[model samples]
Structures are given as C-alpha cells and as structure tokens.
Target: MDLRRLAVAAKPMHRTLHALPRPNCQDHAFLQMRRLATTDFSFLLPRRHAGLRSFSSTQSVPLSEVMPRDGSRADLKILPTDPDYLRLSVESMANMSRSEVSQFVFMMNSYGAVILSSSNRKEDRLAPYTMLDRLFGTPVPHDSMNEYGIVEINPANPTSINTANPIKEHLPHTDDAYTENPSMFCTLQCIQNAPSGGGETVLISGAELVAALSNKELKSLMTPGMVSLGRRPASDGSWLKVSSIPMFWVDKDSGWLQVRWRCNDGCVQSIDSAARPAYEQMDAVARHAIHQLVIPLVSGEVLIIDNRAIAHGRRSYEKGEPRIMWRKNYVGDGEIASELRNGLCPSYSSMFEGMWSMFEPKLVAV
Candidate 1:
C-alpha cells in the first residue's frame, strides 16, 4: 500500500477523532492507533531536510562528548553568529518597517532568539514594551509591578543576588519556570551598558539540548511530577507553587518542544532523587561551551528570546557598573503572521512528531 495515500485517507479519520469528546481509555487507544497509522506514514513522505537546516544555524553535537564527565565548564569559546545573533542598523524599534517586523518574527521563530541593535537614543522606556505588545500580545505582569509588566534590571544594590544585581552571574534559566504556564517569549532592552565589560547575555537552545539527550535522560526529564518548581507569594498572602511539574514536554498545538528549567537555589523546590542525575546532566549540557551563545547587548539594543525554546542567563559584571536592562515576558497570541509562517516548511511538524510519538505512551501512562 502507498503510505502517502494512506496518510491522505487518514486525515478525515483524524479530524473525526478530534471532533469526539474527551477520550476515555478505549477512545484514547483508538486515537493513538489512528495517530500512529497517519504519522508513521509521514516517514515515507518526501523529506525536505533543507528547510530544517535553514531553521537554525547551530547543529546538534553529541551530548556525551560535548561536555566533560565531571560536568565542568568547557574552556572553548563559542562566538556569536548568524540567525541567532542579528544586528539591525535601524534607528529605533518603533521605526521598523512592516518588512523588518516580519523579518524579526521569522528569525525569532526559526532561531529561537534574536538580538537587534538600533540607534534610537530617546529614554522612552515604553518603546520596547510597545514593540513587544504589537508582536506577541500582552506582557505577563510582574509579581509586584506596574500593569505593563515591565521590570527594570539594574545594579540597584550590590548585595542583592536577584536580576537586579550585577555582581553575581545569573545562571541560564527560563523565566517563570515556577509558574504552571510560563511566558512564551521574553525581551531585554539594553538601556545602558556596563563600561567595564562583562554582563554578556548567555543563551542555550533547548532544541540542541534535547537533540543531545540520551533516551533514558529524556524519559527522566519528561516524567511528570518528578520535579517541583516555584516559591512566590500570591496576592492573597499565600505562597504560590507548582508542586509537580515536568522539565520537558512537546506542545501539542505547535509541535514545538517546551522546556522549564531554573538553576536558582530556592525556585526549584525538589527533584525526584531517582531523576536527579538526568536533571544534572541536562544542566551540564546547557552549560557546555559548544551550545552557548554569549552576546553583549549595547545601548539601544533589544534582545528577544523564545522562552519556550531557549534558556538565557547573564555573566557577572563589575560590581556597581552602570548596566541597565528593561525586561518583560509575553504570551503568544497563538497566531503567526502570514509573511513569517509561509517561510516555514510544512514538514516541520513531521520532524517532531516522531519524538512526540515516542514519548506519548509514557505521558499517557502517567
């Protein structure tokens, strides 16, 4: 039988499966069988590897060899390059044309992060916020801040160890990992730069990290309730927490991998002792030099990161140095502009479907 023809025939059945109400065991089994029938056929489709290659500049490296067994940081230095590190010579974020905005969206979706530099000198702090609102939607409000969800990252007190501190290195972490639904995207606009150097932004692609994982490690990371994240006070004077959460899962809607990880001391309440080794291995992979992109944002430069796809951190700068950044988190509108969406290959979903299929049974069993 021609698998292509079977795949085509299976779509109507899949739609019927979706139309049915929430599935019970029988229905779920039927759905899984149907999905396997269709998706397995995807393997026979004409593969378009070129589009996948164009999606990101970084290539997957062997996880076992990428870092040392002791998990120490590598001495290698990886330079900033292409799609991930873009330098736009535009005057200001507000002045960007429609095409430029489209370009930004495409690059962000493809590479998972982008650094844009502009010449706008006006102290209009709202510029970055407004631009983000236009692109991704409303910002996720800060725990205790203005309605705009803007948080200033400046060297306020040298003793503090939070984002406001410039003396300590901020380990790579996905913002809002404590929350059940973390922000889909985040932005950092450099209002000022540290004159003494340092404070460079560090980014690691979650896709690259996932690609390097062993099956055992991936399974351990994906196990729900194996981790506990969050420890913040809610409005009712009660502490908010996600007592059980997974470090990795595939978003059903977007077919994109989602990762929630924070290396902070208090944020991660606990990890399943059984899965501790895998969690530590993941951290090691993220910190490996080959997977890191260190970029220093200068004044008037804005950095946008797909929080769902990349983890970001900062290098410690000279204490009391005048470095300032405006930070905000945003939830996607679940819609991509036509100009940007058209550039992506339709077969992109096929690439992740196999991974999702591999893990679906385990997720369902849990």
Candidate 2:
C-alpha cells in the first residue's frame, strides 16, 4: 500500500516540529484568527511516520500540531534572488489562527497564487491538501496516474504518464484543462532542485488579463464555444483519449470566471475555426500576463494556485540537472478531508465522459 493510503487510515495522530524552536506569535491578530476560524485540523494531517500507532476510527481525534520535518528556513529563497524577504513556514500550519488562515485565503483569491517557504516531508503534502479540503472541498486526484505522488520533471526521462517534462518549456496553461472538472486548486512542493538552475515556474493571472483586454477581446472570449483540445496517453505511450472544452465559462452557481486555456499546438488547433480571431486575441493577452510574474522555485518551498483564476507553466532547465516536485489537487468550497480519506475523486475518463455527454448536445445546439 502507498504511504498516502496508510495516512488515510490506521496511522495515529501526531505532529512533527522543526529541529529548532520557533517563536509563538500570540498577538492580537492571532487571537482574532483563533476566535473566528476554528476547525479541528488534526484529522487532516498525516500521522507521524516513524511511530505508528492505532487509533479508534470512530473516536473524535484531537488536532495535532503541524511539524516542520521537511525543508528548513535556509532552503527558502525569493524569486529574482531577494535575500531580505521574510520566508514562510509549513510547520505548525494546522495550528494557525483564523486571521492567518484568512490571510492565506485572501492572497490566493486576490493574487491567484500564494508561495509558502517551507520544508516538505514525505507526508507534508497532506498539510496543504488537508487545509484546502477543509476550507474548499475534496481534492480531485489526478486521473492519468494513481497515488498522486511525486512527479519528477525529467526531460531526458519522459514517461507516458507524467505531466512534468524537464527538457521542455511548458507554456502557460491550467493543469488538467482537459478534464471535465479541472482541479480547483493545485499545490506544488519542491523536494529536489536542478543543479544548473534553469526551471523557473511562470504564472499568469486571468484577472489581470481580463482587466487588460479590450471589450472586443472580452466579448470574443465570453462568446461561448471556443473549444480547447487535448489528449490522454495510454499505458503504451499512445494518445488514447482526445477531449475538447470551452476556453472560458461562467460557473452557473458561483457566477465566477473560469478558464480552460492551453496554448500547445494541438490545443490551439482545437479552437473553433469561427473563433480563430478571438483565440488569437486571447493568446496575445495571456502571453502578456505571464511575463509579469515569473517565479523560480527551489527546494523547501510550495506554490499553491487557484486553478480557476490562474495558469502556470515551467521554464526549460539545463539538461542532465535533476528536478523533482510533489503535486496534489484539491476540489471544493465546503468539503472535508475525512470524506475523501478513502481516495481522491473519480478517475479522469469517467469524469470526462460525463462532462462530454452533457456537452455534446450543447455543442450541437451551438
């Protein structure tokens, strides 16, 4: 069984702190946060790996402290190499106050991405996914691959299943843009760094692009039927499942903006011929947005993104240098961790079939 599967059940609840002690900032802001966003958080974290113990599945588990067992403060560095910026930590994340939680949420909502300077233990991926699951809903797991484990971006070692390609520069695009319900949020944790220093992560803000586009471009984007194309690879490295999705849509329930932009050659060809002009305009605008924020992530840091509001990509790195990253996706606004403890959401094929079934009729109508 996978470690993640072990974490879902049988593991006892506990916390791991960093080797060094940290300051306890019990200020007024912290107090206010504790007063407001009180949610029992221990059930969401992975239990201590070394000391395995049993717990009653039916009993109410006390929330444990989040231990910083992975990366250290020294490993964190700001993009463009700024030395004075304050580094964030993943230690004790389960114990953060309501205000602190609100701040993180606010940053993600407003800026479309938030960076946390922290260490990642093998089990540390649970911290962010659990937190997001508590605040949002269950994380929609990756379909093409099970385990949702470490995805190493090794170009020289491209596999049929992995999304991270080390040698190739990934253009700005939403992760799983090909899926029916693309992951609502994506979290990336760095475990190893490239030796030659090339693969910087690039981010583009949808909100920024929306604000900058002319009314004509906005109208074209909002004009309903711009299909973005993509494919799923089979076990034998063959592309088996081809999919098409609208580039942008408004969620009927939330009235919020959602996007499915992919600039890859095949994806671009999937755009409706009638909508080519609009696609060209959107392409230009998206390029401008990403140029504004390029981030170089090193080991011991995590980047969380709002999938609906931002598109992210990786810069090409020097060949032969190694880079490894862990990624997890979470879904929902009100879902909890325990509900999804057994496993992530349905497989991608099933989810996509359902989405396409509903969409085919609409496409015909259009």
Candidate 3:
C-alpha cells in the first residue's frame, strides 16, 4: 500500500453518493444465457412489488446485439506492443509535463488491466502516481484505520483488513471490500523482487468468471442482500460490523457487469442460510478461474487493474526471500476520462443493496 505517496488537498471534494435508480434491463447476460439454455426459470421469475413487477426476462436487452465484447481485450499477460498496454512508461511520463489522460482511459476501457513499464535504470515507481492523479482526480484513502492513500505492499506488516500470513498465498480479492465504493482502479508498482522468484501476481476477469458459470449459478450469485463479510475492529476500542454486500452486479446504463468478491471478505460470509451454498460455490469457481491467469512481476513493472472488473492476488514466496511492491487505490474522478474505465459507468453503485433490490424474491426464496 503506497498510502503516503498521494498528494492530498485541504479543500473538500465535491462528490455525491446518490446513485441513479436501477434500470429494468441491467444484467442482460443471465437473461440471454437463460434464453439460449433451457434452465429452470422458476427461481428467476419476476416478483410483484407493490403491484408493480420488478424484472422480466422478456424485456432484457441483448448484450451481444447492443454492445459486442469485441473491444481490445488483454489480460495480465499484456506486453508493451499490446494495444491495451498504457504508453505511460517512465521515460514518457518523465519527458511530458502531464500524463496522457486519453491513453490511460483508452487502455482501461479496452482492457481490464494494463502493464506500465518503469525505468530499468532508476526507481521510477513514483512516476505512476502523477499519471494516476491526472487520470483519476482523487485517491480514496484505503480505510479509516490507515488514512494513507497509498500503502507499501509488505507482507510482513499486513493490515487488519488483510490478516493473511506473509509467506502464504494471498487469495484473489478486490481491495477495500468493506465499503460501498472500493477503489475503481488499483496500481501495484513493483519495487523489489524476490531473489528466488516465487511470488507471482494473479488476475481474474469477473466477466470471464461469470461466463464460465451456468445461468442458474450466475443468477444465484447475483441475488441481492447483505453477505456478512465480518467486522473491522479499530484502535479506539470500537468495532464496526460490516455486512450485507453483493458479490456481482451490473451497470444500469452500460449493461457492463461489475464484480466485487474477496475470499477474506464478503465472498465467504453468507448472511442468508439458503444462499450459503451458492456463495460457497461462487468462491470455488472464482478460485478455479483466477488460477488460469498468473503474472510474474519483476522490479520495474507496475500493473494497473480495474478493481471492479478484475480480482487480483499474490503467490506465496520463501520465508527468507525479499518481495516488495507499492499499492495505491484510486476512485473515479467523476471526470469523463476516469468514468470511461471498464467497470465505472456513471450510475455505478454497490449493486448488492442498491440496484439489485429486485432480486429479493429469488435471493430470499433460495
């Protein structure tokens, strides 16, 4: 967590928390997939709410017909030549007075992740912060406990939110699972590499994960309500119980899916007894999907992934070996460029309790 690196201002930010009403045709994937495959529709039927129907499968807009997923897609293996790779290299960022805001947005929208090249000769890990600030105006503080916007990803000093052991495999999860808005994008700037080369970065696309699951499983996972991810005990002798969150949701405006699943957080905690099986099954499937794309990061590379669309983790390394990386989380600037990010459509909200209120029928029924 490179929490100390960001520049904070005295003036208060002008941001609003209210989100747009949930659209009728938000998630088209499950609907379309259901149409293609004759699975049980009994669980997914629309429920009458105050004499008004909530959702109907026949009304859902086809995602493929509306917006094809043919945009420039690249995973963690993105190289320099890949169009998804941001050209904000150490040299380019150093040479130019301002970061290429357009390029950053393009790469972010095209691919859920981008590999930023750092200077081999010098430690230019700090350069990405300048570029990030330009792209996303404000850096959201990691948590109330640690107010720093950036944090050094040292396994030795794991935070309370992350209690996993340093040498153990860090499971795939999005940063700040305890909040309504986790960072829209996260940067992992490599500072030091382990001598034995055991630690590797792992990334999993949420879209791909849903694609792998059956329609029934997808519908079950999207059920709205609190997921009971546990609590956050602070130093003030007070503890906050964090519960009732969703794992996967979609943008009402774009129909683009957004996922927020952390093994340590809401992924394992099922508040609803009936949904426990679905939640557990989702975790197992997510673990399977993440193993498909593992990336090795050396000392001079920074990886920026869409926090909402992709899940990331680290491989366990030897005890004596050294591994160091700086991490920073950035929320959408509400500016055009930052809003264009893959999972950050304007009406974005924590779909768990907000836009997905309509799922109460199936979610509770299960």
Q: What is the lDDT of residue 295 in candidate 3?
A: 73
Instruction: Please give the lDDT score for candidate 1.
Output: 0.59
In order, the Cα lDDT scores of the candidates are 0.59, 0.48, 0.51
* Pairs of residues clashing in candidate 1: none
Q: Which ten residues in a row have the lowest lDDT in candidate 1?
A: 70-79
| Candidate number achieving the greatest TM-score relative to the actual structure | 1
Q: State each model's C-alpha RMSD to the native.
A: 13.4, 17.4, 14.0
For residues 248-342, write the lDDT of model 1, one tens digit per residue.
76564433346777764445677888877767777777777667778877877788777866788888888778888888877776334222221
Per-candidate total of colliding backbone pairs: 0, 9, 11
lDDT of 2 by residue, 1-366 (tens): 354454343322212222333323223354233322221233234423311232222232211111111222111111212211113454444344565565554334324566765343444544554555566566565543345443444444443333434566666777777666677777777767677777777776554444444333443445555665555442354454444655555554332346666665343436677677656655666566333467777775778776776777777776667777666676755532222111111111111121222222222212
Candidate 2 colliding pairs: 16-67, 33-98, 33-99, 71-119, 136-332, 137-332, 138-331, 139-330, 139-331
TM-score of 1: 0.69
- Using TM-score, rank the candidates from best to worst: 1, 3, 2
TM-score of each: 0.69, 0.60, 0.63
How does residue 364 of candidate 1 score in lDDT? 25
Winner on TM-score (1 vs 2) = 1
lDDT of 3 at 286: 57
Could you tell which candidate, 1 or 3, scores higher by lDDT? 1
